[model samples]
Target chain A: MRLSENRPSPRVRAGRELPLSGKDLLGLLSEVLAKGVRIRFRASGYSMSPFIRDGDVITVRPCKKTDLRKGAVAAYVRPMNGHLAVHRIVGGTEAGFALKGDHEPIADYPVAASGIIGVVDRVERNGRRVRLGIGPEKGLVAALSARGLITWAFRAFGRNKGSVT
Target chain B: MTDRTGLDRIFKPSEEIVAREIEGELIIVPLTAGIGDIEDELFTFNASGRAIWKGLDGRKPLKAIIGELAAQFEGDPEEIEEDVLGLVEELVKRRIVVEVV
Candidate 1:
């Protein structure tokens, strides 16, 4: 029998090193609006798992600074480059929200809050919409939505130890 | 504290460096170095910060930048100066730009 492939294959912090461009930005925003607010996207890794998986297509919408809400999943595109990141919001003020991987215990940072493109509206799997609420850990999308809990559990297990990071 | 001497105060945008347009706002890649290391980084500005950034034309002195700004906006130059300097300072601290000569 052939050996199985390793898990967590591509752990990218943002996106491929490719420069994100205006066209790319437009491409990302276009996914919304099936009509108007649009966005562009790409996918990799299982960091968000069960909710967003490896090979899952992420839809990005160019969001107004005002559109973001606490606990919403958001994509952040920086000024100097076009790479992107998707994370959950735990804390935020009227200004912006703080971000972190659901599986990780530590808070990463607060994104500009204003530059947020769009919150993840839904996830598509093999042409099917999995009908998921943002944080549930059952509806395929929501199952993994439990987030940092599983990663934290995995860490507590020490099956891999500090190596998990 | 953000660096004072690093920013040229007169930043000129070129093809390589550009403003990031998102959510009806613009963010410029300051002429600093390796500012892209921190992933998921997002910086925002209030209305006044936006005005100060637009004033950066690579010719105006930091002081003058505030004066030109005070005329259109409501704050006193002395007060706005602090905010202006602070914004530029933080931008510099992030390695977004070097103080121009």
Candidate 2:
């Protein structure tokens, strides 16, 4: 009956159900504590060799398609199924834009504007927050994309096909 | 036994499905569908069932999970094993899931 009582983690063993999924948790803290935040209970195996590994928490900022700049990551509903895919913009589109992960050694494909979710402006790492704003390191991501390094291992091992570069 | 080396099945063009726990229920939205059908099939579960379902990552085996869940939930291990196997069989049949490492 008591939820926390059944949890396995000592801190969470009390069955303290944290209703805050990464997304809701970010929004709640943003409004209450007034700190910019964004995250969600994300689970997927598509994007590979991401500087961000699977199960890592990220801070996303909801943005408009017009606001998307080169080298910013966005999460959006797939035009087909609306599955949330977190990837960075490699090329710009007047309607939507093209997205590919730095680790993905695939070609750049365009997604419709409707599929766009939000730009990931930051991520919470270890206990500190890291912001993902535009910068020079963008070149590194490109070179890796060219070499197909970050995503090479995952592409060889990922469940998803090597579709996007 | 697994179907094949993870390589043979890796590039067969499987659609990406979005699954999430919304309001205590797990919802899987298929990214690619049969056109114009707004509602896809849904899978529902209770609290305990959800716990067991969450444990079904591509890694662990069905038998191992039964023993783990029995201890965690304080249930009959044999009975739980049957239940877990039944669920896995159903999931595989539906094509919503695949046995993978």
Task: Give i-RMS (Å) per prediction.
Answer: 19.8, 13.5
Worst 10 residues of 1 chain A by lDDT: A1-10
RMSD of 1: 19.1
TM-score of chain B of each: 0.67, 0.69
Over the stretch A5-85, how does candidate 2's per-residue lDDT look in tens digits?
A: 333210111101333344533333223112222333332344633455554455555576465766667765444544456
lDDT of 2 at A32: 19
lDDT of each: 0.50, 0.49
Regions of model 2 farther than 4 Å from truth:
A1-37, A40-48, A93-95, A128-136, A143-165, B1-101
CA lDDT of B39 in candidate 1? 18
TM-score, chain A only, candidate 2, equals: 0.55
| Model 2, C-alpha of A115: deviation from truth (Å) | 2.2
Per-residue accuracy of model 1 over A1-165 as CA lDDT, tens digit each: 101111101122242334545454434343332233433234565555545665565554445555565556677654335455666666666555665555545555556755555666566666566444364533332223334465555466564465333
DockQ computed for model 2 against the true two-chain complex using alpha carbons: 0.02
Compared with the true structure, the alpha-carbon lDDT of candidate 1 equals 0.50
